[model samples]
Target: MRKLLTLKHWKNTFAFIYKLLMSKEVAVRDKLLFLIPVIVYWVVPDVLPLIPIDDIAFTMIIAEWFAARMGRKYNIS
Candidate 1:
C-alpha cells in the first residue's frame, strides 16, 4: 500500500487513464461525460448559485465508472 504513494505509481495510473480515454472503443459521449465535471469546475462562471459539490460528486461517480470500464475492457485488475 505504501509503495503506491510514490510518483511512479501516480505516473502509471495517469498513463492508464490516458490510454482509457483515448481508446477507440469508448464512445464520444462517454468521453464527453468524463470531461464534463472537470470542465464545469474549471469554468466556474457557468456553475453559479450551486456549490462545487455537484461537480465533485459527478466527477467521483464518473471516475469510478471510468476505472471499472477500463479495467473490464483491458482485462486489468
Candidate 2:
C-alpha cells in the first residue's frame, strides 16, 4: 500500500489511464465501463449520502482500479 500514497504512483496511474482512454485498441464499451460510473457518481454524490468520500478521491480510486484492470486485460504496460 506504500506505493499507493506516493505522488509518482498517482502520476503514473493517471498517465496510464490517459493512455488507455486514448488508445483506439480499447473498445468504446470498455472505456465507458470506466467513465460511466465516475460521471454518475460525480453528478449524483447524494446517491450514497452516508459515504463521505470526495468526488476527486472517488475518481482517483476508480482510476487506479481501472488502470490496473485494463492494463492486465489489454496487455498494456
Instruction: Provide backbone clash counts, one per model.
Output: 0, 0
**lDDT value, candidate 1, whole model:** 0.65
Q: Write the per-residue lDDT of candidate 1 for residues 1-77, one digit (tens) a residue.
A: 67545768556665666777887776678678667767777567464746645655555455666766767866754
Task: List lDDT for all candidates, in order.
Answer: 0.65, 0.92
Show model 2 residue runs off by greater than 4 Å. 46-50
Task: State in Å the error of residue 16, model 1.
Answer: 1.1
- In angstroms, give how far residue 13 of model 2 lies from its true place: 0.4
Model 1 scores a TM of: 0.54
For TM-score, the strongest prediction is 2
- TM-score against native, each model: 0.54, 0.88
Residue 14 in model 1: lDDT: 59
Q: Residue 24 deviation, candidate 2, in Å?
A: 0.8
